[model samples]
Target chain A: MFSRDRWQEIFQTIGKNKLRTFLSGFTVALGIFIFTVLYGMGNGLKNSFNEFFMGEATNTFSINPGRTSEPYKGFKKGRAIEFRNDDIDDIKKDFALYLDEITPVISFSATARYRGESNSYSINAIAPPYGDMQKTIIMKGRYVNAHDMAGFAKNIVIGRLVEVDLFGHSESAVGKYLDVGGVMYRVVGVFQDDDGDNEERMIYMPYTTRQMLDQGTDKINEIMLTYNTDIGYAGAMAFDLSLQKYLKAKHNIAPDDQNAIYLRNMADIVQRNMMFANILQLVVVFVGIGTLIAGVIGISNIMVFVVKERTKELGIRKALGATPASVIGLVLQESIFITTIAGYVGLVLGMGILSLMGDRFKEDYFISNPGVGLNIVIMATLILVFFGVLAGYVPARKAANVKPIVALRDE
Target chain B: MIVIKDLHKSYRMGTNSLHVLKGLNLSVEEGELVAIMGSSGSGKSTLLNILGMLDEADSGEYILDGVPIRNLNETKAAKYRNKFLGFIFQSFNLINYKTAIENVALPLYYQRVNRNERQEKAMKYLEKVGLKNWAHHLPSELSGGQKQRVAIARAMAAEPKVLLADELTGALDSKTSYEIMDLIQEINDEGKTILVVTHEPDIAQMCKRIIHLKDGVIVEDSFVEQVRASSYVQ
Candidate 1:
């Protein structure tokens, strides 16, 4: 296949018509470039979305209280609804077998101070299961436990950023006392979240201790829950709906009052996101194929002109005892050579640009690392070869069918 | 080496059919240097085409080297054309893009000879035509006489049984024409059968025999006192 004479002939022919060859090759290269970039960008966008939901559980949902939209019994429609500790205890006791983890949360912004250095941070009071549910990484010490909550101890888990704020990085903040909201609390643990300092600006403590610190109010802000959902989307939604009804009954809200109890189904959002990603992938493939077809058409058009130009030469070859297959092979080989080389060049350039852009946009969730996989590269190579063959076929056939006598007489 | 019996050919121009070759019967034995001569539209070109196997007769028997050349497929016909017949055209129809040596090597390429062997054979033939020094030059770079010599070298490289020349000097001056004829005569002296198709009486007189055609029939077929092409001053 790498015969020197054949290669010389191909190069000579291509060299004679430099502009035509370059234009045709450029179209194929452009098509491949667009294909690689579009598909890579599509996957990158989907990856960014997945990154947002990575640390938190996919099967988890949260419940938050809202203003009653519909009255029940003697309750007014505009009445503000709020959750209590008793509701959290009842839900945990009743759904303990079905639930994976459940936690009650109450948060408020407060100042953390150790000696002279002080910085404002959000204070989160949660149960022991909160750390495991939110995938929080404990840097030192332990989180608030059942014993701490039962005894209503003033123990707090400071975020890693809060630790740095209250005490310098050289000192350990755990086992030290920090003043939070004018109350002294011992730091039980130092932890971090996936988003680095963004999540590390908050601190955690026992919910019971927070309630006592807040002047004897038993009101809880929200309840976070996760359940086993191997039974799929419909079954999970059915369980969620039943749990919503149970919450409605406990809160004395009217049945079918949708605004009274706000529920966020993270599992449903994950499923919807996966569906959108699949559709995006299909769209990229379709557009890529369309561009490839246009490139192939451009190649065929140029090949027709080339075949016409070589009519006399082909006739001379045929008279010299060249077989039809040999004549056809000449044309096909040129097309394949041009397309494969140009397509490879385009692939490399497109991927290189994407890699640079990915680094530039690293801080944004809209686009992540945009690049093609090995399978896509392999598939693109095959498609380029196929396009080469398709583009060369008609002109090659015309050259093969040329009669030596007629062609020789042609001016 | 070549035989034709009752050969007929025609052309169709829309509604009109022009019968070119009426009932031609001829044969040329081995080692014969023959020339077919006639005026324009006398069907000599058609006869040359049929004899070269570039075209088929409507109804006739054409044989070469004891093999009946009738109804052979394109592949078989091309094979026989390569092995038995070599053609030199009036315009010195060498591929313009190829260098002189590459043009000479082309037939050998189709014969599936390896690259080294083809190059060696092509160089030897170029030397025979006395154009060895100009081999690497393209056809465009060579003069009319040099181009014809390159075409002759290309034809001889295949080592075919019969060499066919169609007005081989029609595009050259009288001096260059005779010089080309001198080269053709030298090739024929080596015992290769050759057919020269021309309209010039002086050119036909240079051959050992002349067959004159008129209205698609042979009017004369006779041996002559040959005038050697080299005897003409260049």
Candidate 2:
């Protein structure tokens, strides 16, 4: 609790020792500043990494065929491998209960013609389930359906950028006819993705229509599959091992041939990335707290000096009927005042730098909005109080313990 | 009113203990102006400190204004000190940073009086001490005599029953010293009991009663002819 007299006294004392007070306050401000900047950068790194997994299911994994790296039985190294359409049927018949959605992908770069406005885009032929599984947000119309695949209809879904390039950003191109390398298809949907230009410069069509155009019957590039619920780290690893064994057995490859087939599980990547982020956040907390502790120690040292220098004044106050509690209150209040003021300065400076950085900096892996959140502000406030109390307690006790008679006698 | 019986105090100088007060007894009626005089090491300072409640006696029975003064906690002791006593120190002891009125308002601030009332009472006391025009000036801006007057105003602002002046004029020249003694005399004439601790015979002669001490015991305690401090050249 502070009165006007107490506040005036604190300010007067601080003003009397300007350099000493500034240096002490600088420690706390610097600590909080470093904390805000470092923790914000850490969050930026985490979110940037998270951008890698965006617009796709975290529990999903993809299998890609690869050349053999080892020989087993009559099979030799360097032999190319490829997936077939029958593999999708076999996987579904066997693990239909465990799988949420499974689709084979076959994409190729093609030039699209919309009334003489041509743009080059990668055209991917996928099953209907792929749109929902990959989180493709259709801005207008609809994706390819089972009827489209079964009837071999000339229906297609164009990405937002492809629409802009071909349709001039005027309106939805749904129901419009577009020729893909002389093969005409009707645009049924327009989709956007978080991956920016890369996802935008693509097109989606039915797998059956792409297979018909491939000339290699039933050939597929990769199979993407996801579970109904999140499969954690251990589960993802176990699934990877089992799937690898099943593929090797079915394709007649060597059991120990490491490169026969490759698997990339989104769940495994998510788990590893999450663990890294958690460790980074924990390190920021420790470093921030460490910086604050150093600042608190500085405050404590300055307060001890203040107590020593004010011995005579304290004695005078005591002789005038100030209780020990009031003496302690005076010391503690001064420390708290200094620390809180310093901490606020740091907070404002730190956040100002972050906002400026956010405004000017371009997006990379960290994506958008690279700054501290509400939790960090709350945490910093709590630290201010803790440091204030900790830094002032010992010196205030010393002030309270002074004997008025002896102190007054001090020269 | 004050009473003390069998008060004893000592200081430890390394392994040996030096006894300062050995079974001292004293009594003073309300409104009396007394002077305590002693040579150095006579333990008069210690006795004055005991009387002011700034130090605890090793053994003593003391009473001031009908309340027993024995091992009171710091809080209660502070309350009693604020309610019953005022002090004017030789060095003035005015908080240097505060203005004259603010320095006078310090005790009332401790008493948790509201700001407006504290300032009003402080100004009243400052006017009583004849420093109303200098109320806003800092102690550093005032002369030695003016600073003592501010300290006197601060002491009396709480309206205590008794005033203790410990060498209140020691740091001032003779002219300023006589002026401060004259002010103290006027205050005592208003029926407030007062005690002055000093070594100067002239200062001691200004009081109605004088107590002499040597080697921790009172050698002489008697009434004396009171001299008017205002009659001295200032």
Candidate 3:
């Protein structure tokens, strides 16, 4: 039976200030819109790079000893650096923590033959841990074992295309012998590459055997090394200067060589991804929180104007048995009521806008189907209530403090 | 009942102070219909406001219901007014936004009366004042006399000990003025103390006693027989 005519009066006041309320809601909606979109896009970009790099050798560093801008060993600025097996041995000795397994890759095209099938394919002479350094995703069977390298085992793993072109299936290639340059080598393992294709062309042989049989003792094109530790940054930094200096001394080159073996730091990609993630989160927070702050300030400013306008009516109420606390309660309730309604309006619009974009936000790297989360909505609602309380505080206090006699006597 | 002793009120503009009431002393017992007759700026409205607790005297002893209230704060004063006082303004100061019944119920609403009960009480008072047909009509829709009638209903609904009417029918013509005076006299006869501010001796003649003021001081206080031209307002 209680008449909340006071609350109805407050509703009427807010209804009269339509544009002010609209602008406040718009600020909150815009904030939520930007936050959802940016987070989705940032995650999407991150996932794309992850997809491209996922199955590749994350632990191994390829040695490219060529192409220089500054002279090494007093050679011309643009010079190609070269290395042999002895240099690889010296590097392994210097940083034992850095070198897990050293695989010497020797590749060349050759005519391979079996009993009824004959095809031309590329051949690779590899050490025992060569498959791990190649970044090949092994789908079936084992890689070359230590015994295969020590006994000079006539075992080869062919590329995907070679298996298809010769036997038409990777499973059939295993346990069969294929003549590599007319030297019959049995298949030790059938493997698939990261791209979902069989890697059958690499006719792997022992490095010692490849040297003894093929007369390639002086030629090892690349030293493929995997770190014993997964702490990439420490391994990379520790190896950079020491490896360059060791190479300079071993090759009898200048100490500060502009052209040394090319080292790729995989940690750079990880660090960039991490930093971008933080930036994306910050951008979302700023845009979203900024909108909420603007809304609160707008409501607060308009409340000040409203209090000023209704001074006379409030004075009359004061003279009519209304307590200071009751006066404050009236204004505060009105403010909270107005902001809550407006915030809900904004929340609905913001969520709707984000959902409309969710279907189109497809990308490979990050979580693409982003929508306004309930936790964020709840947080926004709490903020609005706090905003209402804060915005109404000063005006309500002023109203409560009014002296009734002076208030009523006002013209 | 209202009583005042050595009451003083002044208005300051720049360095000059204009004394509105100077050393005034008077008393009105319950059931008394007292008309305060004074010209414009003779401080009749000022005295009325002070008695109603709507303004403070610079120096005075104002005792209403045997309690001193000269220095009471706004909250206490509002409480005092709500419990014991009602007012009828010359301009019929009913809130324009409120219906006649709502206007009548304003005091009860402040006192936390139940909604339906407050409406019922408000309508009863309005019917007594012959305004029940216009219960939902706003002040803007009513004639000047009808608005005053609504004001009277509001004043009576609260059942106050004293009704202070500041120029109660000042804006009405002669006939409406007498009708309002008759209502006030009827209320006084029923044991409510009524004090009216007026410039016309004709209005003053309707009351049991008259207090005449000039230059903010009481010039005379005596009972009047009747106005020679007296007739029913209808």
Better of 1 and 3 by DockQ: 1
lDDT by residue for model 2 (B120-155), tens = 999999998899999999899999999999999999
* Per-residue lDDT of candidate 2, residues A97-118 (tens digit): 5677899998788899998699
RMSD of each candidate? 3.1, 2.9, 7.0
Tens-digit lDDT string for candidate 1 (B1-234): 888999999989899999999999999999999999999999999998888778888998998988888896667667888888898999888998789999999999888888899999999999999998998998999999999999999999999999999999899999999999998888989999999999898899999999999999999999999899899954
Lowest-sum lDDT 10-residue window in model 3 chain B: B225-234
Per-residue lDDT of model 1, residues A129-175, tens digit only:
88877888998999889999999999999888888877988999989
Cα displacement (angstroms), candidate 2, residue A376, comes to 2.8
Q: Please give the ranking of all candidate structures by TM-score, highest first, separated by commas.
A: 2, 1, 3
Sort the candidates on lDDT, descending order.
Answer: 1, 2, 3
Indicate which candidate wins on lDDT. Answer: 1
DockQ of 2: 0.59
Candidate maximizing TM-score: 2
Runs in model 3 with CA error above 4 Å? Answer: A1-255, A269-297, A359-392, A399-411, B91-100, B133-150, B170-182, B199-205, B225-233
Q: What is the interface RMSD of each candidate, in Å?
A: 1.5, 1.7, 2.9
